[model samples]
Target: MGWYGQVKTNRQLQVRCNYLNGTVNKYLRPIGGITIVADIEQMKISEYIDRAVIPLPKAEGTDYRASTITPPFGPRFNAAPPKPRGQTGFKLDGNVVSWANWKFHLAFDARVGPVISLASIYDAKKKSYRQVMYRSYISELFVLYQDPTEGWYRTMLFDSGEFGLGNFAVSLEPLNDCPSGAVFVDGYYAASDGKPVQVQDAMCIFERHSGDVMWRHSDVEREIRETRPDISIVVRMVSTVANYDYILDWEFKPSGSIKFLIGLTGVLQVKAVPYTNTDQIKEEVYGTLVAGNTIGISHDHFLTYHLDLDIDGDANSFMKTRLITKRVKDKNIPRKSYWNVEHEIAKTESDAKIQIGLNPPELLVVNPNKETKLGNNVGYRLVPGSAARPLLTIDDFPQIRAAFTNNNVWVTPYNKSEKWAGGRFVDRSRGDDTLAVWTEKNRRIENKDIVMWYTVGFHHVTCQEDFPVMPTLSVGFELKPTNFFEYSPVLKTVPPQHLSWANCTK
Candidate 1:
């Protein structure tokens, strides 16, 4: 019902009648119909005021709950480190010496069994010296790829008993006793006795779905010839690393698209940026507004591409295809400011033209001079989202520094500290952790230049089951925090919500 009509005829009828009589000089004094005219302005004003003053029910806070969020996905259960399965031991007989943390007690037939090399290093903490070694297996076979997605590539490591790099050992042993002109098949290494060694483990074949063994390499070639009419294979050895290992990187360019993939295993740590007293610029520049021991963070932005193919012939005559994309750009600030493009198109065998162009993006300032400092020589500390006001003294600087230097913070070898991955202090004579080497030839660590390096992997404690192929793994890097916000510096300002709502009501 209409508000005015409902008010006059219903529960408020008495109030409305009193209001009308007061404005009309009591109905008794009303003149004849033609001469009487009522004033209605005061009654309308009273009704408006009553409606405006009515109270609204408050919103319920308890029901406005948020759902629990989960962390990024990782392995369901951690696998224990692997144990050696072969009958091999260290022999300290010649210039080719080897070592291991554990004692070597086994022997193997020289012709068919794998040779082991051990190198020793004194461990002050353990109050003893230990030996480290490397054991490898070699083979040739066909590997298959099931999923060819951009970031996720699934391939089977076939033709070996265990076809992946595991936590083995590594050492530089001399190869003096190897046959002068004989060609080594695959898993070949030198022993501490200066003699050549070969791995004897049989090749392993894998089932596509369950990751189980379907056939051994000894039986696969025969079975495939009898069943499938056409097949292709490549010659490569399946090997493992010892205590320390580096990632095997490859740049794939298919149809003018480039994609870089890094396979990981072994011990790895995250990289950190360091801000020291020396990084401060003496001149007052737009972005060089250093406050105290603090300096600004910087970043490099660039683009890369990826490709996929659909082939239908032998390795030589197969058709090729690809996709282009910008994998990631330098992110100095919270929000990302870049674009991505992808496509899929095929090309005839003769028409294939693939190239890679690794171009650097235009350099731009991220954050202007902001207050920053090295927190206890562990990590870079900064007041992000705004410029830190000028600090008057050293005490004031440390106060701001203490707030960000708690646990879970770390320093890495990225900038001047890049001389060592664990940071420059580990093996340097200066005893200063921040000491870095400046050289033009070293791409990973340069002096005073800002760069990002991130290390990723699992911390493994040794166990029996991981003796073979370790699981596939990966980690990532991020542009460190900087003031190079893409838009205006005041973008963080909050607007007046209540004032805007009131204006809308008026």
Candidate 2:
């Protein structure tokens, strides 16, 4: 039964059978539907016996199918011929990439998919390559559906762990998925039976020019103009986990920035509805009615990333440059107010835990010992993209199990056993070995070899456009150079020449 705006609204029916006990007992059957009537702190289960279980209308009806009887008949149509463009600029020496004075080793992992190692950038002033991040990868992703029905109550899925990421990688669609001139890489993994299988073209590497200026200077007095075009190399991989497809990209910039991006697309897992139109629904439905008898449920996606940043050979400290409004204290000025910067150095694990807000402080990981030419600490600032913190309450079961998502950012001293945010085997894990459990020790992180963990999430509210298939939803974060460089890294790089602008007549 659907929720009718009741306080105890979750209607999760428990389907009891012999399959759960690993025995075939024909006498076993379902007892009753269990409804969660309590708050998120203490979930109280109540048996719902009066409601009748009825089969919903199927979506294969004629009104729901796309019609081919229109004037534009369904047939193959030619769009344009493929103009082959050759690859240049980037040179790959067997999994090692060397571009823009940045060198790193990219390897495919069976669980995490792509693990980047030995990332370093060439420092012009030092005349040597400086180590940035030693290794970084996506730790885990926890997705939970909003529906409180028995079928979806325990829908907490550990996508990367439960099903190996490399096992689900699909072949790239040459020009459609990735741009032309992209180099494809194959992935190999072991199956459940211990037999090795390979997926061809599982990842693609390419360089793209978005026509953005990296740096610009125009001196009217000197009659000189200079501008450098922005160019980047992206390592792309797509994995299909059951009904949803995830597109992950590791983008490298010439300006010394590493961007981690994720895109969610694919068919939606919809529920069968009974109403055909708005007039048929007397009460509020829990989801959106995409078709005649289909309801796309609401859900949330939370992804945790493990970053082992070694800025100038580890021994780094986390600092928060907080900006606060300051009223003018000078009587001579007669001004109203201004903002002031207050620097806060994190001394402990608890001090480093961050909860993002409208105007959060500038988070930076810096080596206090290493100074730039300006005498400032060499560091990299974390720039977040479109992301959300987990909305699930801290005391909830799924929240406790995935406690790493409680805060937006967390820094801890490097520990080998603390890889997965939800523990090693998270198929149906409890809250025992989670990140929250590890942070309880309150270890010191200041000026130590530390690891940073950030959670990026999205609270999805279903709409009509997300009916049968959903458009790609992307969210990510970037690690950009901050005082680590005395000036722009691409200041001396050459810029591409612009071509003649085309008119309508061609």
Candidate 3:
């Protein structure tokens, strides 16, 4: 009944009120064969079929509150670190954040959780901030389930387009969610009734020092040792999308690198089965049996990002430096093979579409007009995340609707209107207005203002550990300076005497 193509109206919804004890957790309980489809616009509802009735799932031991647990808890993994004595390194002037050598503007959007714009890093050598990225954000997010049952076939979700990621974002907990010195920021949005609603503590920003070194070198023969502290500023937010919680982070480092992290955690979407144990099953249940009569369905998640990278200026081009293997022709050569880098400039959007794999080329967005002193292009290279492509066929409805995920990386001419990857209006949307359709035009992109779209994804195959609640699973990508920097910026950071170790005798 929820199947859109089968129904006449696209605004129709199929609803089932299942029971887990007295609570309705539709995933763990199914009302068996009864479905009611209602249309929101026309205000019409079709008659439902009542073929069977199943027993309600017992919701014993479902309480997750800290006070309700009877057994002793396990040992804690982390201890509170020592508090800092000095003022924080980062400064928050309204929405503009300045930390170390990086300055960026951060804003919350109803569609996407966070919008990072005018992100430029300062160059001490030049004594001016250079353009790195103009605007960057998560364009669209698609989560597709793999169950083929009648009630679950149409379980795909366009989280960002259909339901705004910011709309579902909840308040972040202090000290627990963020560090002790984190600065909290609030957000506001218009409600359905056209009233401004404020979401307090919507985001937090803090500098992270995880006891990791930025750079280190030791020379016993020369009696020399040096190291630099690894410090980075992090802007964090958590969006609660129904049964899933997404933790989004934007990290800025002193070396002119930016990282985007997507952490997924929440209850698993489960199905009520007839049998209680896996030993009693013989056929494909479409998932793994986690608990009594509960089957956790397998699924895939894809979050496509719209990165408008301006390496040094607005005019930029995409370059793929492929590492192709070269066989040794000379028999006297000791090495059997070596890899040579073949640089290719993407002339059009079609030329930039790439599928990353075991042998992925080095993807970069560089300014053709700007170069280092050695004449190397000024660019920021992409470090791809744990990206996963859809296993479904291209003709599949979900695959077609989210056709942007066909490739792990894509480059398109900067068009202001073409922001959303799944389309403008994703409510019961088809594949018509997807990113794949727009790229068919294949506009010229060489040395022009272009956007690079990167997909951060993962395939989730459920296990017993993900049952009652799941641990946070994270995956993301990084944009690092390639030839954009003249040399490592960490070399200029003066370390304190405590960290310098100059007095130690070798």
Candidate 4:
């Protein structure tokens, strides 16, 4: 009996080891059900560590070069006018005439990916205080294509840090650095007491592949129309949050693809944390790492969802529901109609549901007392278990579902409001919010519903020196295959190739 107990305990210990390392077996029988819970608690500490290191497939060859893509515009500073209106007397007759030109400096470091490098930092001793500087990484690649014949431009899909894949677009006009369609969509009036004055410029990056435009207009139009339209677009701007100071622009392609690009002109600072693995470190040890060195925690990840009601004759609009731990059978609270309630009540209920599970310490609510900031016009909180939880686990499904069902609000062309990111009215200076009005008109004409869903994720392990000016990091969202696409759009495209020194030598 003694020997048998020893063997059983050994087996349990082994199981615990696997669980802590994220190699838990789905079908393994526990020695006893009660003991498993204890093991899980003990294992949770290391589980946090596992979440910090996202295991991407190793690059097949050393010679594989990262894409040489810069933001279509110059850096954010360049995008700003040389002088503010107070200094430049361009505002003749009390009406600003020629606005200062804005440009974006979107550059990516070839040495390393944003996520990897931003998680590492360095310190320099300046005159008085020890100054820290962070390196920048490639958050995402934004590719804009204009099918000259079609008379419309669309953005291509690319990877945005930890966020999943989707079509993302940024509306840039000849006049301003603000997202083209969004400035007016979100309704930031310069006349407002605290809003910045409107500035316009006409400088943007335009790149064209030899045959990409021709191929798109000729052979890709039908394919593009048939493609899924649930693309994602996000806008990142300087905000009150500590250490998060970059504006992200996101969009969904008409092809149902997702695209995201980074607009960096924000404050960067070093944040100190208790430990590399906080939970694992004991009471006496002071575990600390710079904020930039932390691997999985993203400044923010925003998701923009556009569902078309015209499809399937609008017989039944597809709705994704949050996974409720305790299932409720009230059909009146149909998942599809959950957003019909009063906006405030809806938001409260949504917050309640997200708070139920394992919540993160850093996640907080948008202040009700404070005046509205960029995307905070609508309320949002970071859902807990973002980093520690599994991507498609039962614990997380409901939160995802709730985001779609509860956070949704019907937007009309006339409604000029903005959330944390993308919406109909993007540009504030435009006389009429084109995208907002267009979307509203389209919704009525086509009898379609426009809704958006967002999710945030994180990873926690970080290093030192990610203080002062920290390096850049990347985060994003994805639009999965949900019968949304008419055909397998990616089927015709070839898989990505692996380049190596050996291939070149051959």
Candidate 5:
């Protein structure tokens, strides 16, 4: 047995032998499973160590054959017919995409992979294109493994900075990673020798329908029924960083909502363990032993985003609209309590540092000069998806390297030098040039051109199902129009209907 958890004891099993040029040493045993002697001279283990004594987990009668497992016998389970071919509803003009009055220019960066810029939506009443987001892209990815050994302590990987995400992007497989009717786009990145290299089919764009209804209502009294189907245009890219593959999708809905999602699916980084059964273990293991000799360690993934929202124009303000509970002060009123909305504008950079709370506030970027038909400020709401906060404290080594994850959200005055959240070159950075450092000046941000940074975090705990290859785990965020549009953007639209087998037979 080998060292399992964080223990101070030096109980290790290393069988050193003079085989194959005398450099063979294998620590194949766990200390918790077997007993060891205090003094090495007292035990005669040196005699057996003359030859290589390390053995495989399967050779020791432990069953770790994941590929040989068979499924249970059952009847045929085909329950539905083949889906009909889907038609495209969006138009592509070079890199600019247009669908349902939504237009955006898609560009690729060597580090960030996909960049969306010049995003605008058409207004039905005004019949003009209104600006929403000027530019947006993934700022950085902080990945750290939780092993403190000599070989595993410094295993920190920055997917974007260390190795260019666009450079390592592989051609997506049709009908597998993306749909059959996707439009593939090429990308380019600079080589180490300062020459530009082309990446073929680095991104795919397509329209998706998930059989979901956007809105529907039925009024039996008035004999009126209405329904609207949900449809979206998606831009996807998958970047394989070492052993992990990250799939990023940007979904644009007709209702003026942009959803940014990231999915992780790949092999787990496993370490060698010795124990085969739980009863044989006396001490605690830091990670779960999925196989007989393999232990998958815990880890965390934090993806920070750079968003420059031009709600109506370049000049905008950040505000937190909170729902506060109020007590009825008038004794004549029968109601005891009520709720009211409170908006607080962020005047300085420090005022915009937000930690997600149980009672979260709505983060909005509004143009102070513009107003909607209802006299409300034109704005877009920053809606967070299923995410977790970075659990590491600020002083930790890993946290120091990625200080941008200190807050879930941060707003700063727009600067061209402040693109990457971690730094420009994050291979072995010392945390000097980070987003947290720039926000320390506490510059004025009220009604000024600003950038909003948000981090989507994940805390992973390995299980048996994550052995050979892990299933995809997803996290995302959304930018939805609150009062930027006068009313429902998809109110006056007609969608196509699908004919079922029963309906076609009749």
Candidate 6:
């Protein structure tokens, strides 16, 4: 039912059956042309629509479970892995974890899965642990599919707020979901009935040793080289929201950088159609036809995070450094124009609102009172990668409620109630309490305890390859030291000692 001017206004749940019919993937088989609209409050069906008789998706080759495959899939590695290392590399006491130069408390939220609180990094120069971010977690995400049809238009979803991330946390597979040496953590959250429900292996902590170098230099002139192995600790959780799996990782690096990594992989919410090839369709499909009788729905994912960066202390300001092009005053220089940084310390909440991907400025959350040895303000830069802005018009219902995606970045005074980017009451929300509405106050945030919000957007245009199950499409952003350290923190650090060399056997 179209929700524009009032077609069906009652609280409703449109039911679509996906019952497994002979080994077919439930998601791949959305029983089309039949929708059951039931008003739970009234406890009756408002409408039972059966418009057309659409052929069901084939039952062949639709099952993805390994056990269902005809030939067994072999193990990832041919040979057994090496023995475990002598050290576990991280210390865990209850919910608190200490790894590398980082120490933080890990807790689970009913709405947001894993919460990293009191996150501080050790400072060798200060001989103590200094606060970087007090607490950080993904607040909400808007998964909006681009289909104007009566059955598909209402697919706009607030993943975390409507369906709690903690509620969807699935137990991770060993050695597959995580490495051999990873430590698993259990999660618990309150159910609707107020009883605590526990999810085992809900999260994992592992030290990633990818071959990528952390730091390396080759001084051929002096015939010398220095290199450090890239070793970082990752706290990971996977939230399966019906048809999508969002793998979230909080990676802490030894080089004083923190990365928020998200990988999207799962079955696409495909629409069943009559066409098998592109040439057969004459009208707007709204998506690509990856399989016979299937149209992969085009969609957008906006993942917004809440970062309460203490930055050595609570009183911090967000800075935007715009690179401005200036012409040479004197025609003495060979270059006609040169660019230099023009810094602006955000005085109010509105001043910090930024739409990324358009001459994006260098973003930094800095403590003005704290300085380095060279008298530079201490700060951590927001290194945005693959940013996105909403493409939908402002009047759209989804855009109105999820107006937080209007800007890639926003800073607001830290408020306990303002944690949810989309209003806390997201189910059937009317955009009255969104971050976009809260910032309308234009409150003063300079030198105040503030929280920074960042949105990572993925504008997915459905393609042939993304049809069945999507291979991981990953995107991430980093928080790196700016002028916080006088020098590279790892410059003077000793390289990790290798315990042994490979032995040549007879």
Best by the lDDT measure: 6
Q: Model 5, which residues run further than 4 Å from truth?
A: 1-87, 332-335, 497-506
Where model 1 places Cα greater than 4 Å from the true spot, the runs are 1-247, 252-418, 425-449, 457-471, 474-506
How accurate locally, in lDDT, is each candidate? 0.22, 0.76, 0.84, 0.25, 0.77, 0.86
On lDDT, who's better, 2 or 6? Answer: 6
The true-versus-predicted C-alpha distance at residue 45 of model 4, in Å, is: 41
**1-506 per-residue lDDT for model 3 (tens digits):** 22235435457676665665643444556555555767767888764666555444556544455666677788667655534422467888989999889999999998988999999999988889999999998999999889987666877888899889888888988777888778888878888898988889998888888678988999999999988888899999898998888999999988888999888887788776776778889988888987777778999999999999988899999999999999989999899999899999999989999999988999999999998998999999999988578899987777878899999999999999999998898877777887889999999999999999998888899998886678888888899999998888778888744543355675
RMSD in Å for all candidates: 34.9, 7.8, 3.2, 23.9, 8.2, 2.3
Off by over 4 Å in 4: 1-196, 199-243, 251-255, 260-287, 291-316, 319-450, 459-461, 480-506
Candidate 5 has which clashing residue pairs, if any?
1-29, 1-30, 2-29, 2-30
Q: Number of backbone collisions per candidate, in order?
A: 22, 3, 0, 76, 4, 0
- Per-residue error for 300 in candidate 1, Å, reads 28
Q: How far is candidate 3 from the true structure (C-alpha RMSD, Å)?
A: 3.2
* Top TM-score hit: 6
Candidate order by lDDT, decreasing, is 6, 3, 5, 2, 4, 1
Off by over 4 Å in 2: 1-86, 217-224, 282-284, 497-506
Predicted structure 5, TM vs. truth = 0.83
Candidate 5 lDDT tens digits, 292-392: 76566788888899999998899999999998999999999999999899999999999999988788899999999899878999999999875577776
lDDT of 4 by residue, 1-506 (tens): 00111213211121211111221221111111111112333553221112122222111211111253334744446342232222321222221112111111222211111111111111111112110111112222211121111111111112231121111112233334442222211112233265543212211222111122211222465654322112222222322122233344332222232233433322222122233455644543212333212221222232232222122122122222243234445877755422221122123222222222432222222223222223321112222223222222322322222222122222221122422122222111121222222333333211222222223333323334333233555554333223333343333332224346443666
Per-residue lDDT of 285-397 in model 6, one digit per residue for the tens? 78888788888888999999999999999999999999999998887878788899999999998899998866889999999999888888999999997777899998988
Better of 2 and 3 by TM-score: 3
Worst 10 residues of 1 by lDDT: 305-314
Worst 10 residues of 3 by lDDT: 1-10
- Model 1 scores a C-alpha lDDT of 0.22
**C-alpha lDDT of candidate 2 relative to the true structure:** 0.76
Cα-based lDDT at residue 442, candidate 6: 95
lDDT of 6: 0.86
Q: Which candidate, 5 or 6, would have the higher lDDT against the true structure?
A: 6
